[model samples]
Target chain A: MDKNKSINQSANKNESQSENQSRYIGVNEWKRHGFQALWALVTNSYLLGFIQGKIYKGRLKNLCVPGLNCYSCPGAVGACPIGAIQAVVGSWNFKIAFYAAGFLVFIGALMGRFVCGFLCPFGLIQDLLHKIPFPKKLQTFRGDKALRKLKYMILAVFVILLPMFVVDILGQGAPYFCKFICPAGTLEGGLPLVLLNKSMRGAIGWLYAWKNAVLLATIFLSILIYRPFCKYICPLGAVYSVFNPISVFRYRVDKESCVDCGVCAKVCKMQVNPVEHANHPECIRCGACKKACPVNAIR
Target chain B: MSRVFRSRRIGILLMAAGLILMGFGIHRGEMAVVFGKAVNICMECIGIG
Candidate 1:
């Protein structure tokens, strides 16, 4: 009986140690998620915008925030960089989008995809969807290498080229990405506007139906996939990723005192191998790897 | 390592140039047009345009 009790005690000790280690590794990720949620709330805070069911039309609306927020969102105080770029590019006069371009470059150079991981409302939604206790479908293989290139194409075609080239008889170009593709616009602007305004409800047509369908698909995919839009379609993320190799705010790996145990790679939701590719364009700078690193090699 | 340093230098220089051009654009009343469109509800984003 004493031998059996000793065996049970040792087993309990091992189990508790394992649980503590797991909790320690996950604590940083929980903290980072909390911070992301807080940042999203702060950025989208024109509380009256939602309650009154009207967009804020103040002077602040002219500026662009460093996230993929929809300008037409009831709570949005700043313009969307992608939408602003489309507007300037699509104009008949062929004016350069200097302010919008400069803003993106400045922010991208400073933070890289840190903005995507932390400040974007749509990214927040995707992260929450991924946490919904479902069997997530992650493409963490050679296919992801090819899939990562898709966002650049979307950026070039939908956001820039199509908007600049395609025109109506009046020579007015359409904001193609926002009009046909952006689930952010559909959720933040379209759904709210239609629901709140009686006039907008009467005007809901095929276009509205099409956009809502796209939004539904995005929501469904996000539940099973980690940030499907940011992974494969976000033009903004593509632009920011160009600066990942040199962005001021980026991950640093300590090679001197390092042992590559692959813990960082395991914790990363973005599927980046942080030990070798610490600043890979796909790394969202979420700091999960830093927390997961057993040897404290990443900072 | 030196190549990475050079790339960062060039990136900073390019960002500086972009900011300068943006300043010039703003001075030329381009901001007025940008802000004019920004203040209005973007019908195109909601698929109306």
Candidate 2:
């Protein structure tokens, strides 16, 4: 870590351009490439299951990656959370999946936005796009603490409750977040499937139009905000926050050497306090804040 | 950390191996989607080709 700080001393690592230009290896580089790689997965058949469907669609097979990936994505090789939840709810299925719950807890405990920062291909796309040169507004760090609470409520209500308790006697479950929300699904999942299969495209109507509008709005809004969906929405981030305190790999702060000098906070993409939630769940482990600290107070 | 990397090496290799096996399973008499069809919709759809 010291060696890295020394090398980047003359070079500001915080700039998205510098980071892009710098030859960073390890997990983070994989993230930049992984976002593209999933697209490669769509092209090549390397990890088709993540884009297509999983090996088994059994009762207990839903414990998996959190963010929305299209189960119908031609190259997908795993089960998507929204799809799994829908499958579970549709079947009016067994006990709440202990494995699924545990997986979410485990991810939250580990890197908070590590999933967002690295693992999630969709989140990576937004991060890459945000790097595109443009002036944008950062959220109100001081004034909007209350509204920031909306994400958690969204996690609870839209992501969890509606799917779990709102099942009808007909035993049908809705992909609440995907059907009604989830811009990732709208853009990545829904549109592609429609375009690829003409039948699905021809059948499109009010629902498709509505989702497209949300997708267009989100894409437009993404240019104005760093990550509009990720900042105020994305229930997965809320769930991951639950495990922030004890996550396996997370930020730690050194208070003694520290001035409460807020360089770290200002550059923070997620607007989380590196001092407060050192391993903050909202933090996507983007490394932006760590690189921002002038005194190297954070690690 | 070296130990961590060593273990990760094994784990990644294992994952690679499994993905390879899965690739093999998915590869019976299949022709690659000629890059032409893939490239056309690559950027807007999946963000890469």
Candidate 3:
């Protein structure tokens, strides 16, 4: 009877140990999903807009959030930094765009691409789309590396130069990137407002058609690739990447504990090799690589 | 203090300076223009302007 009791106790201990190991396996996934959900809530918190179908135009509209929330979205309370910057640049009486520029610099210096990894509504949308069980396109071609520089060009040309220089017959500069390339505006503002306001449907022209096509293409690409816009086209992301090396909040690796394993590289969605270039400009600081490290070297 | 802490202090100072600059712009009414633009639905941003 004593022997049988001891055997039962040992069995229970083994079962509990197995349960603990299984619980740990689920912990990382739960933490990631929880963070995403919390950020989504924080980003889209103007709940009254969905019910009333009107934008909140209070003092909050003056301040810009770190994430890429559309300023024109009915649910948006805070202003968009990119749109604000473009407006300031396009203004005839433009002095320096100090407010917009300062806000961008502050956010970038503090968090770097942490904003892209966790805060951006469009980035979250892309992340969800990429998880939809389709075969992903991971391997990069020769042109892929060169094409990655396109966002900087877009920033220089559309966001900066065109807004500052390209003027109409009336000598008024236009926000060219917003008019031409921003899929966020199409998804958040155009589609929502057009669906809500019946009168606006008739106003839709070739420009609207072009924007809608861009939105569709972005959505399709995001389903196959991870954050196509963020990786290749988001000017805001381009701005943030420049600060990754000098940002206050950044990833740290314990080289002492790291076993030189390539697991982190294998798991990184942004194609960043953690061991070689943990602070690479292209890295979004997503923490997947950190989680993938077997020796718990990254933080 | 460690070099990391010193770097962090510099970053914080830069961020503070940026905020001050933004505050100056607000005093100069630049933020008001940003607010005005944001309050209205941007037709151009939505591909209608």
**Residue A138 in candidate 1 has what lDDT?**
57
Q: How much does each candidate deviate from the true structure in C-alpha RMSD?
A: 6.4, 11.3, 8.2
Q: Between the candidate structures 1 and 3, which one is better when assessed by lDDT?
A: 3
For model 1 chain B, give the 10-residue run with minimal summed lDDT: B25-34
Descending-DockQ candidate ranking:
3, 1, 2
List, residue by residue over A29-135, the lDDT tens digit for candidate 1.
56767877787677678878787778888888778888888888888888888988888887776556777888888888877899988878888888888777766
**Residue A289 lDDT (model 3):** 77
Best model number under TM-score: 3
Fraction of true contacts retained by every candidate, in order, equals 0.48, 0.00, 0.68
lDDT of 1 at A280: 95
Q: Tens digit of lDDT per residue, candidate 3, span A1-299?
A: 99999999888876754553344332144466567668767656777776655677888899998878888888888888888888887877773678988898889889889888888888888887777777656545577778889999999899889988887675557889999999999998888888877777879999999999999999988888778899999999998999887788988788899766566776677888878877788989888877767678987
1 or 2, greater by TM-score: 1
TM-score of 3: 0.88
Tell me how each candidate scores on DockQ against the true complex.
Answer: 0.50, 0.03, 0.68
lDDT tens digits, residues A1-299, model 2? 99988778535534543443242222134445556556435432424333432222332222245554544454444455544434443335431433334445545544556666666656766766665666655555465566667888886776667767777786544557666666776665566556665555566676667767877887776766666777677777676666555555657789987666556666666778788767765677777667666567787
- Please report the candidate that would top DockQ against the real structure: 3
